[model samples]
Target: MKESTGQTIMIQGEQTGILDADTVLITGNVSVPAGGTLTFLPGTTILTTGFFGINVEGTLLAEGTINSKLVFSVADTSGFYNLYDSRGGWNGINFLSTDQAGDSSIFSHCTFYYGKAFGDSINKMGGALNIRNFSKIRISDCEFKHNKAIFWGGAVFAEESDLKITNTEFSDNFCGTPGPPYGYGGAACFRYSDADLTGCRFYGNSSTGIGGAVSCEYSDVLITTGVFQDNFSGLGGALGYLRSNPDRPVSCNLFTGNSSLFFGGAISCNRANPSFINNTITENHSVSYGGGFYCNDSAAPVLINTILYGNYAPEGQQVYIWDVNSSPSFYYCNVQGDSAAFGGTGGIGFNSPYLYNTDTLPLFSGIYPSPFTLSDNSPCINAGNPDTTGLMLPETDLAGNIRIVGNVIDQGCYENQSGLTATGRVNKELQILCYPNPFRENVTFILPGEYHGNCSINITDMSGKMVFSSSSMKGNSFNWNVVTDKTTGLNPGFYCVSISAGKVNGSALILHVE
Candidate 1:
C-alpha cells in the first residue's frame, strides 16, 4: 500500500476508481463526479489536514473487514474542541442526487469522527454524512462519534432518500444552535425519507431542539431491536417524530435514562401517530411534562404490549397529552399509575376502557443492557394481543430469543426464555443461596445439596457488565472477600451472580453497601 503526504489527491489518475492505500493525507476536497464510482478498500485511512471532504455524486463503496476497519478523520486533532463554532474539522461525506447508472452505495465497518457541518444552507447539517435527493444507501457496523452539526443531524442527515442502517452505533454526537430554533437529531435527522434502522445503539447524543437521538419528519421510519440511552434534548429525549407513519412500526427496543427539558422523556410526537409495540420505556425524566410520551397537534400513538415504569414528570409520570387533538391508547401494557397517572384529556382516561391495560407491578430482571426483561413470576407473561397475525412481528425478540415463547407473546421487548434451553428443551432452575445478602466486604455462595463438585461463578453489575469470574472452584461453598481480592472490588449497587454446576444454571441478585 502507498502513503501520500500533504497531497491534494492521492489517486489523481483514477479519481473515480479504487483507493487502496495505507494512508492518504489530503489537503483539498475530493469529488467523485457524476457517472463515476469510488471504492475504498479495507484498512484504508483518509486523513484531512484542513476543512475538506469527499463529495459523491454517483456512488461510494467502502467495504472494510472486521479486522481491518476503514477510517475517515482529521490528521491533527489539536484545538479541535476549541473551535466550537461548528465550522471546525474536516467536512463530512456528502452524497448528492445521482441519476447515473450504479448500485446503491455500501459502507460497512467504518469509523467517522470529528466531522462538522457549517457554512451555507446545504452545508449546515449532517456533520459526518449527508444523503439527499432520492439516494439509496446501506450502512452497517459503522461508528459515529464526537461529531457536531450547526442545524441538524450531528452525525447523519437524510432527505428524500431510502436509507438502511444496521448494527450501527452513535455516541457523544451533538447538534444545535443557541437560538430558539435550535436543531434536530443529535445523531441523525431524516426528512421526507423512508428509513429502516435495526440493531442500532445511540448513547450520550444531545441536541437543543428535538430528538437527542433521532428526529424524523414525514418519514416512514422503522426502528427495531436497538437502545437509546442517556440522550438529552429539549423535546424528545430519545426520539422526536413529525407526521411519521410506518407500516412496520418501532418494536423490541429499550429506551432509558433519557431526559428532556420540555416534553417527552422518551418520545415526542407532533401530528405523528407511530406505532410502538413490545417496547420498554423506563427511567426517563422530563422537567416539564410527559415522562414517557408527549403528544400534540393531533398526534395519537398506539402502544401495545409495552411497559412504562419509573418515569418522572410534574403532571404525567407515564404519558401526557398537550391538546385534545392528540389521543394515545395503550393495550395490554403495564403502565405505572395507570391512565390516571397521566394528565390530559386525550390520554388514557376513565372515559375509555383500559384496553386490557394493567397496573400490575412488572417484575423485571433489572439487568443492564436489558433492564426490563420479564422475570419468571412477572404478570406480563403470555399477556400480549393474543392474536399477533397482523402485527408484523420480528422472527426473534430483542435478545435473539423466539418472539413468542409460550402460548402468547410477552408484554415487552424480551421474551421470557427462563428454564428453557436453546433447542426449546425444558430445564429446571437450580437453587443457589447467598448468605449475608447485602454485605459490605464479604459474601458466601452455597449451591444445592443434590450435587456439587466444580462450579463456575460469574458476577455482573445491573447493566450486565462482568465484574468478576471464577472457574473450577472445587466445592459447594465458596467464600469471597471483596476487600482482599483487589480485582473484585465491588461497588455499591445491585449485581447478579450466576453459578453453573453440572446441569445447574441459576442466578441470584446481591446488593453491596458502602
Candidate 2:
C-alpha cells in the first residue's frame, strides 16, 4: 500500500497505479495527459481540498470490491461545514476525450459525495463526474450523494458520450439555482449521447428547472428496472426527455412519490416519442398538469401494460397532452380515471382499442419501493394484451418474476401467480361465472346446480359502496339491472359483485359502460 500525501501531483504521458489501502491527498488538481492510464486499487481514498479535482484525457479504472470501496470527498472538515456546505469546496473528476473511439473509463463499487461544479459563464456541468466529446464510460454499483451543480447535472454530465450505468444509486443531489432552463438533471444529464441505465435508483434529488432525476436531450437511452422516488423539479419530477430518439425504450421502471411544481410529476416529454412498457407510475403530484405524464410538441409516446394511479393534478390527473400532434397511445393499461384523465386537445383516442383497459382500482399491495405489486384479487391479473410480438418488454417483471405466467400476461408491472400452481392451474374448483362482463345495462351470473339453496347477490363500486343487492333468490341464473337501490342508474365504471349461497361465498369483477 502506497501513501502519497502531496499538495499537487501531475502524471503526464505515463501509466500509474494507486495500490490498495493507499491514501492520496490532492491539494490541487491531478492531470492525466494524453497516452496515460491511471488505475486505483481497492480501499483507495482520494481526499481533496480547495478546488482540487482530476482531469483525465486518457483512461481511468477504479475497481473496488464489496468490502473495500473507493471514496472521493472533500478533505476539509473545519468548523460549521455540513454536507451541503461543502458543495463548492472541491471540483470533481473530468474526463475529456482526444479520441472518439477508444478504451473506456470504468468505475465500480465507488462512493462520491459533497463535490460541486460551479462552472463559469462558458462551461458548467457535472458536480461529481463529467464526460465530454465522445468519451466512453461505464459505472456500476456506485453511489453518488450530496453533490451540487450550479447549472446542470448535479452528479454526472455527459455530452456526445457513450455511457452505461447499472446497479447504482443517486440521492440527495441538486442542480441549478432557482431559474428556468438552467437547472437540469439533479442527478445526471445527457446531451447528444447514448446511455443505457438499468437496475438503478434515484431518490431525494432536486432541480430548479427540469428532470429532478435525469434529463435527456437529443439522446438515445434505454432504461430498465429503475426506481425513481421523491425527486422534485419544475417539470418532470423523475425524468425529462427532449428531442430524444423514439427507437429506444424505457421499460419495467417504477416512479413513485415524486413531485413537480409545474408539469409532469413523473415524466415530461417534448418532441420525443419513446416506448414505455410495463412500468408503474403512481403517487406522483404536479402543481400544474400531468401528475403521471406530460407531452407537448408532437411527442407521441407508446405505453403498453403500464399502470397510472393515485396521481394528483388539477388538469390531467393521469396524463396531459398539449396539442393534437402530441397524442400518446395507451394499450392494456390500468389508469385511475376515464377519458377525463387525458387532458387537452386529443380526447378518448389517447387510449387505443380499449379492449383491456380499466379505470377501476388496481388494488396494489404497497406503494413505497415497489409501488405496483398486484394484490391477490386484483383485477389486473391476466388482463394485459397478450399480443407482445413487436413491443419491447423485459423478460422478467419488476420483482424478477417471469413476465408471462400463463398464456396471458398481467397488466401493470407485476404478474400475479398467487392462485395458480406450478403448471398454472387452479387448485380449487371454479365457484361462479359472469358473462358479458363489460355490459351496457345488465350482466348475467351463473351458479352451479348443486347449490340449490337461497342465494344473495350484492354489487359494490370501486369505493366499496353497495350499489345493488338482492336477498333470498332461489335460482341457478340471475341478471343484474345495473341500478342502485334508490332506482338511480350506475355510472360507467368498474364494480365488484359478491354472491353468498349457503356456506359458499364468491366474488367477481364486472365493468359498466355506456
- The candidate maximizing lDDT is 1
Which tens-of-lDDT digit does each residue in 203-235 have in candidate 2? 999888889999999988888888998999998
- List the lowest-lDDT window of 10 residues for candidate 2: 421-430
Regions of candidate 1 where Cα sits further than 4 Å from its true position: 1-14, 82-87, 345-353, 419-514
Task: Give the clash count for each candidate.
Answer: 2, 0
Pairs that collide in candidate 2 are none
TM-score for each predicted model, relative to the true structure: 0.80, 0.77
Once fitted onto the true fold, the runs of candidate 2 whose alpha carbons sit more than 4 angstroms away are: 1-15, 19-21, 77-87, 347-355, 367-371, 419-514
Residue 47 displacement in candidate 1 (angstroms) = 1.1
Candidate 2 — number of clashing residue pairs? 0
Task: Give the number of the best model, judged by TM-score.
Answer: 1
